[model samples]
Target: MKKYLKNYIWVILFVIFSIGSYFIGFKPGLVIYSNFNEFFLEMISFIPFLFIIIGLFDVWVPKEALEKHIGKESGVKGIFLVILLAMLQAGPLYGAFPVAYILCKKGASVRNIFIYLGAFSSMKLPMLGIEIGYLGIKFTVLRTLIALPLFILVGYMMEKIVGSNFKVEEVKT
Candidate 1:
């Protein structure tokens, strides 16, 4: 019971706050609760599909292949591949973390993981189309040009900080 409470403290607090706010007629709290509910439902609907894909990737893709392609020595080709993967992904930024974890476990370089995350946040192809449609080609292109190099630099700096020997530990369910 104690362990369960510790693990779910935030969720418990959120429920309490939502209910308390409802009784007190707090408009902002109600709005926050509503938003949380919507987001939670969205995640619930999407996460299973994401996990299925991740599982398939884990089982089907050889670890040796991943290491060969994106490990510490992979360099520019790895960066480009990571960027392409990020761009092809369609979902919220939060969805990228699980994939990153899998990548890390499968032997992706820390730099490449960071690059994948950075590119996913800024350069998703679906979002690019929307941005171009609404914000014009020039703005979108300029943003992409600026973002790509910055993210790459950030990834490099993060790799230096984290060191090339980093490895992710597996979490037991």
Candidate 2:
């Protein structure tokens, strides 16, 4: 019971705050609660499907394939591949973490994992269309051109800081 309470303390606090606001007629608290509720619901709707896809990827793709494609010695090819994968993926940035974790577990380099995360956050293909529609082709192209190199640099720096011998530990369910 204590462990469960500790794990869910934030949720309990949120519920208490929401109820307290309702009783006190606090408009800002009520609005925050409403927004939180909507966001929570939205996440719940897609998280299950995301996990299912991640599970399939974990099972179907072999470690050797990942190592050959995106491991420490994969070089520029790995960077480009990870960027392409990041761009092709569609979802909120939070969704990328699970995929990145799986990639790490499967033998992907730290550099490639960071590159994947950076690109996924900024350069998703699905978001590009919307960005172009609002910001025009020139701006979008320029931003992407600038972002790509920065992402690579950041990845490189992170890899150096984290070291080549870094490894992800398996988590038991």
Candidate 3:
């Protein structure tokens, strides 16, 4: 109980704030409620499907295969592969964390993982269609071409600064 409570204190505080806002007036409270409801609905519709895919990926793909393809020695091929994978994915930014964790555990390089995350956050494939529709194909293409190199640069810089062996740090009580 204590562990759960400690983990969720922010949620509890947010709930309290929401309730207080409700009592104070509708403009703030009702707006918050409506936004929360919309976001929750979207999350419910999207996140489960993503989690199922991640679970299957975790179970089906062998660590050795991941290592061979995306490990430290995989070179430029690994960078391109990771970017392609990230672009192909659908879901919120939060969905990337589990996939990143799995990749790290399975021996993917830190630089490639960082590149994957940068692409995932900035350049989703599905969103490109919408971007081209609204912003024009030239604009979309230019943005992607520019961002790809920057993301790769960031990945390399991060790896250089943090070292390749960086792993998820455990939280202590």
Worst 10-residue lDDT window for candidate 2 reads: 59-68
Candidate 3 runs further than 4 Å off: 1-68, 169-173
Sliding window of 10 residues with minimal summed lDDT for model 1:
59-68
lDDT of 1 by residue, 1-173 (tens): 99999999999999999999999999999999999998788667655665575556556645444334776678899898788778767789878888888889777899999998999998987677666655779999999999999999999998899897776555544
Clashing pairs in 1: none
**Residue-wise C-alpha lDDT for candidate 3, range 64-169, written one tens digit per residue:** 4433588778898998778777876667887888888878877889999899889988787666655665577899999999998999999999999999889844
C-alpha lDDT score of every prediction, in listed order:
0.82, 0.81, 0.79
lDDT of 2 by residue, 43-74 (tens): 67655665575556556645444344887778
* Residue 70, model 2: Cα distance from true site in angstroms: 1.3
Candidate 2: residue 30 Cα off by (Å): 24
Lowest summed lDDT across 10 adjacent residues in model 3 is found at: 59-68
Most accurate candidate by lDDT:
1
Model 1 / residue 98 / CA error / Å: 0.5
What would the TM-score be for candidate 3 when compared with the true structure?
0.59
Q: If both were scored by lDDT, which would come out higher, candidate 2 or candidate 3?
A: 2
